[model samples]
Target chain A: MTPASPAEPTNPPLTRRARRRNQLVAVTGLVLVWVLLWGSFTWANLIGGLLVAVVLLTVFPLPPVTFAGRIRPVPLARFWSRFLRDLVVASVQIAWLALRFGHTPRSAIIAVPLRVNTDLNLTLTAEALSLVPGSLILEADRRTGTLYVHVLGVRTLDEVQRFRRDVLDLEARIVAAIGSSEERRRVTGADPAGPPEPTRLEGTPT
Target chain B: MTLDAVLDIVAAGCLIAGALLSLAAGVALIRFPDLLSRMHAAAKPQVLGLLLVLLGCALRLRTGVDITTLVLVGVFQLATAPVAAHMVGRVAYPHDEIRRDLLLTDELAAHIDRIRADRTDRPEVSDAASAPGRG
Candidate 1:
């Protein structure tokens, strides 16, 4: 029998203390990232990243804390391996393009379809993809499961086709690494090559 | 003078120019009475200003990796900012708070029928449809 779809809850509530704790964690994480990246205890960069994160959270609030659906913790070792591999691949691609194609290369904007759901997963996917040199996520239509991306140094239609396939593969690995166990079961069944199927989530078609 | 000193001077100059331009753009945002003008102010100098800042960063960094990262960031910002601004204007133009008196013509209103036909998902009252109504 097909598993019963998880029912959506409206306004998943968070305790006041939980909210404060989350904010603290977020701030701490930001400081750590800043120090790691800059290799110095620069208060300026730390504060700047914090402010940006705050603005982002204010503009886009988190999905309500729903009891029905659970987030899967990324397997740290696996996630690191895949992330590093992609980073290396992207850097090499960019370097190759710079050497061969000069600064301005023929580029196109294409939308690739994916199976991932949830704002957080989609966002993390986009950010990860964007760190790659030759490709950047322009926008993601979460409702449609499509990501608009700008790719550098494409010469022909065949290249575009390969690029599209590469994006799909990248997204699949990301989803596999980050998706909940239930999401893995649901998405693996859906054909990633085809048009997105309707989400089984209980929300009104958002 | 040492290479570091020379690099520092160039970086400082670029940083100063970038800061001034950004400051000008911020002032214009407050000073301008209309949305379009404010955007015009924002787009021109601020973008160039940001480029200068990136250049400054690249100059200051003695290592190749830092320079590469700064350049990549600059390129990404350049590519993304206009798209974001366009999207913002697309959403914001429909709002009543935008001053209509300052506009010459609202092209969105002229093409409202076509736009509505194109995007059935969006409300007819959205900024994309109301572009021409500002005049």
Candidate 2:
């Protein structure tokens, strides 16, 4: 087990003022997500991503790892940009689906085996997948750390493969964004220096 | 576009959508035979539909304490809905059998005794059961 970060704050020590700010940040993120869904606007998406990042950083008090200090902000500028690009690409694909098929599109549950094992990263990946419109996280297995997503439309295996690729890419970006090196190591079963292997973890991309 | 007109359209849409979803929830609750099934119906559409209605109302009455109250109502519902369902499930646990078709594995069946003990200690039957008894 990785050691907890030295800088990680213990739960009981959260001060009232800090808690209040945290609550405020959480609420703001909620409002932003609500607005984004309501409007489906790109600007709102950017704002929501930043707001969520801030909430995760400030409000989500990471537990001390067995070895690593508290997980804090890693400079993931490239990761964020990549995620945004994926978001745009997925959004366009969803929009195309909406426009091309008015209502009677076939949908199926695709099993997506995740590369990341951390529960937090899994959840974030699920949430992000769901946000990509026309995809919903139907069920997740923490034991095997796989996710089943119901894709709005599916007609071919190639489409499924693409969906799997995009989702894994998204998960990788999220892991890079928020996870500690120890967490990554635990997930990939590799030393921090080694490349993440393509494990049995795969998703049924619709 | 007139802001008032835009707000009016949104408000109307919210109210309609909320009412429709709440109606669906009511139908589901009434149609489904068991407590868990009823809970399945009650949880999502009812909460979301009511929230939509509340949002619509809040949009219409955007200026004052009404919005705050709506927010409070939304929060209260968000917080309480799951808790109430949990309590109901716990109460109905022992006697409330599941349909074979619906359940894959009765995980809760293993801890039936513990659930019954908890209910016996509290014994606060929900109004749902009472209404059915009256009927």
Candidate 3:
């Protein structure tokens, strides 16, 4: 079997403006970490963090992580609210499953074909799924943008379809929030259509 | 009761719940059947538990300094945990650690096969087709 090629460029050169922005973002994050470690946000800590951040950025310049999408606040807000609600719901579901102890929860790994092909979209969707209690991404085929996710409590095919639809819904929300116009159109266009066809391999029964 | 007393009770509840969730995570890690399933146990509750504990600590401390640190801890944990779990899951799949019977579909295998055929059809592109992190 051939392995999946890495989607990310190893060291793609960044534009001058992009480089500056990357450095600024990194510095800001580092400075925040510094202040947190110091357990204060006084002038002294802020100044110290700033100096350290600048020095760190200058000394060790990292390859720029390119995001081909811009943030749309409305969609972003929608995503967050829905995510928060799902987090609570999933946690309660897991807690119930844990408490039930007697019944063996039937779990299955379902392959979901992703329409959103960008690295950022794929990564975000996987992270979101993994954060939720019931599902976790087992493997991602970068070649086809397919995610193999192990989901708890899927006994029937209908439940499997529902899980797949949930993933697609999340991807749509994410694309709407930060994806480019082309990505947004693709997602929107595919909405009326059914779920993307996923490649299936027969599993041998134990 | 007074506001401070009420806050203290809420914080205590958060801490207790967080601790219990973490305890449940440990149990699931051992009790789950296979590698991928166990990873769900390993990743989810642990993160939520940590977030709750951090929230409790932040509420109890209430100062600018302690709260900042707690916020940082929660943010970083939320950002990093899923990525780590993804990496673990990715590694487990190629190694056949996941139970085959438990998987309803194996799209990854199909994708790999397609890639292999495509590579075989064009020998010159083999170098480019060679996936990173695998021999």
Candidate 4:
């Protein structure tokens, strides 16, 4: 009950400097994409790619995902290493589940209310969770900053609870890697009120 | 053996592993009972499988331009696969497509009513305009 914040974090007001930086980031990424797509980086390619990036950005405005945090090399490296390992492990588990006979895999839908309810945090957490394991993003409630994850194969209530905890843990790791300093405290300090109690259910089905 | 020969051997192994994962995904598609499960099964393996296959391809090519193209494919797949899965999963839920009996617990059910209410309350915020009969 205490996990999610009472109010969602509104998008931070962007200064002119912030807006320019965001545009610069977008332009650089897009140009790199164009160059890579062309499979060469000659002067002609560089100039052409820049033109294309500008045109594309002008035509289709991008979403305002305020990146308020700086990348920490140590934590970023940790995130990548862990992500690659989980990708392999999850693939193996899913493969085994599919190949095995007789057992019908039990699934559950778990609502994981995030600790830091920023749009950036919510989006990254959802994306990472879907990739890492038996979890899939069913729906992400932006208003409440909750992610409803459909997890494959959980035979009991304990497993369900464990998965929820894992989700929170994953969210924390994500924040550590790239969340703002203020947001990082929310993870490090954790919920001030208390540990999250199990969400009340409509009826515990047998 | 030479370096090229050893690299070729590793590349072949990656290709084989990717193929096996893809096969597993196909098997799950048929064996899984419902739309949600099948969609989940069909999509997840293919992601890692595609990455492995691309890695093999990059190793075999061993050229800058080609490797960048392979990298692009991997990047795009990583970005888009989860989004595609999410789209399918949301539609599968609250419908006959989900084998409700097989679901151990549906935490979403508790919040479904309020979610629907919000959707109807602010149709602009939702994709309700895209619903077949309405728009």
Candidate 5:
């Protein structure tokens, strides 16, 4: 028989206080959404939204996905700026590529090893990567913390390595911004003397 | 031009650009070779295009409620689109919908094979190992 591996719940169970807080946030969000959909903020809309929120929460609670990450201002600012820059740059590049139908750019599905292990980190990194125009996540094996990404416009091995580095850098920034202290330590400890360096693939040129 | 005129021009630009991006996504969907690549056409440009369209809506409506709603729609789209894409990708991979030739490194296939071998050696443990939830 396969040894019964320790069954770790995908999301840590929430405490009573945390549950209350989540409910409050959910209610407020629903009310705001209600007002927006109506294009007006009135007492009736607010009350209706609150009622709906309560009913929804009671009837169908969200799956127990833990929200454990905390925001670090400096790293978050850096991450946002980088993300926005990449957004614009990638959009333009993909748009241009698509319009130039004369030449078919080479594309490939490459595996990316992720150092960040938490569910939140994995989700955020995958989402961020997919949002960028040229790259999309083809498969995420949480079992191995590996992401298979389909990337456009990669014609050379150098470009592949560059893509890998970019992904690792993105993960590091995410770990810096919101990762738990242990995660932060692991990231920094990997490169003790200087900034966290991306793991280089063997045989890839420096 | 007056400030109102400027806002109108900017909003018009956003709307036009967003429409064009959506058009590109459609074209790519048709032209791309396989399921995996076709997904690239289906997802990326569509989200950005929706975002641009939302921005234009916010600019044109200029009311607090409308702007708030538009922003929320964009946020929810940003949060959900990738997840949907991921789910589709996951299903496609196992079903062999992917064109194997386009892959440079298929770590997933190797990983699955290794797990399968391990399971075959110890049949009793295979159920838990193959289950969808994390280990």
Candidate 6:
């Protein structure tokens, strides 16, 4: 479901070697999950997990493993630290909102258009945004790369715009951590990929 | 305190903090007006709460396999919670349960077909939805 040629017109297809590498990565990750689930590192668990991973891969036919970028350690570490902080903040904020007496929290449904319109970027950003406390993704437009976020406890237009900018900044951090140079450049406003165009289809009045 | 005592004390604190977060989620479930806001309560605080509980469990247990299992639970929660929330939110979005009144702005309304609120929809949401944001 990633950049089906026209979406990533400039991108090249993955070669056989690259495809193999992707499969290996997937299998390894699955195996790790399986082993972790079992809670032990026995031969049986290892073998069983491998068998399951292989079967699952064969059945599912791995989606485009189109990670054309390298992981930057510094940004990745920063991203993790920032993420944990956000997580704590989100939890505390939610807890406070829940406990505060007689205060009905105002919410909003703000649609944020992502700078990096790739499927992976959309998925990752949506995942991160939703996991954060105040924000939830109601709908994501894959074609135009927009996330309709349901935010809790916002009081004004400025806050809504601030949330939008925060979403973009989050996208920038994600791209910095794992996106390609081209993708990173796009987020930073260099060679604009330009999909924030709210180009929706036939949205009618309520 | 001795080292083990200190670890146990910290573990107890983690457990208490985690339980407090869970309590917050429970309070949120009752107090949050609409279905969507309740979903935020259901998903967000509980995740951190569960992770804290697991961390406490690991520190107290100090066993390899058990810690690994706890880690697995945390991983699964982190991975699946948002996805579950998204699916539920998508379904809830088109329904009358999502209080458009309490919503300061519905920018999503402009981009998609807004479902007209059926006056005789679910009573719980209708009552809560009518309850103006007292804040």
Residue-level lDDT tens digits of model 6 in A70-107:
89999999988888888889989999998999899998
- Kindly indicate the candidate among 3 and 6 with the higher lDDT: 6
Name the weakest run of 10 consecutive residues (lDDT summed) in model 6 chain A. A1-10
Local distance difference test, each candidate: 0.53, 0.53, 0.72, 0.80, 0.70, 0.78
Error of 1 at B72 (Å): 18
DockQ for all candidate structures vs. native: 0.04, 0.04, 0.33, 0.40, 0.31, 0.29
lDDT of 6 by residue, B2-112 (tens): 889989998999999999999998998999999999889878898999999999999999998898889889988988888998889877876798777787777676545
Report the Cα lDDT for residue B69, model 3.
77
Better of 4 and 6 by lDDT: 4
Leading candidate by TM-score: 4
Error of 3 at A18 (Å): 3.0
* TM-score ranking of the models: 4, 6, 3, 5, 1, 2
lDDT of 5 by residue, A47-110 (tens): 9888888788667555434455677999999998898777766666666766777766666666
lDDT of 4 by residue, B5-31 (tens): 999999999999999999998988888
For candidate 5, write residues B11-87 as lDDT tens digits: 99999988888888787777666677767766777777888889988888898877877877888988898888877
- Candidate 3, residues B1-135, lDDT tens digits: the string is 998888888999999989988888777777766777767766778887888898888778889888877888888887888778877876676666766666555556655456446545775432333222112
Clashing pairs for model 1 are B106-B132, B109-B132
RMSD to the true structure for each prediction, in A, is 13.9, 14.3, 5.6, 4.6, 6.4, 10.3
* TM-score for chain A, candidates 1 onward in order: 0.58, 0.51, 0.82, 0.92, 0.76, 0.83
Ranking by DockQ: 4, 3, 5, 6, 1, 2
True contacts kept of 1: 0.00
Model 1, span A9-93: residue lDDT tens:
1222455665566666666765555554565556787887788777765665443332223444555456657765654454444
Give TM per candidate.
Answer: 0.43, 0.41, 0.82, 0.92, 0.78, 0.85
How accurate locally is residue A122 in candidate 2, as Cα lDDT from 0 to 100? 59
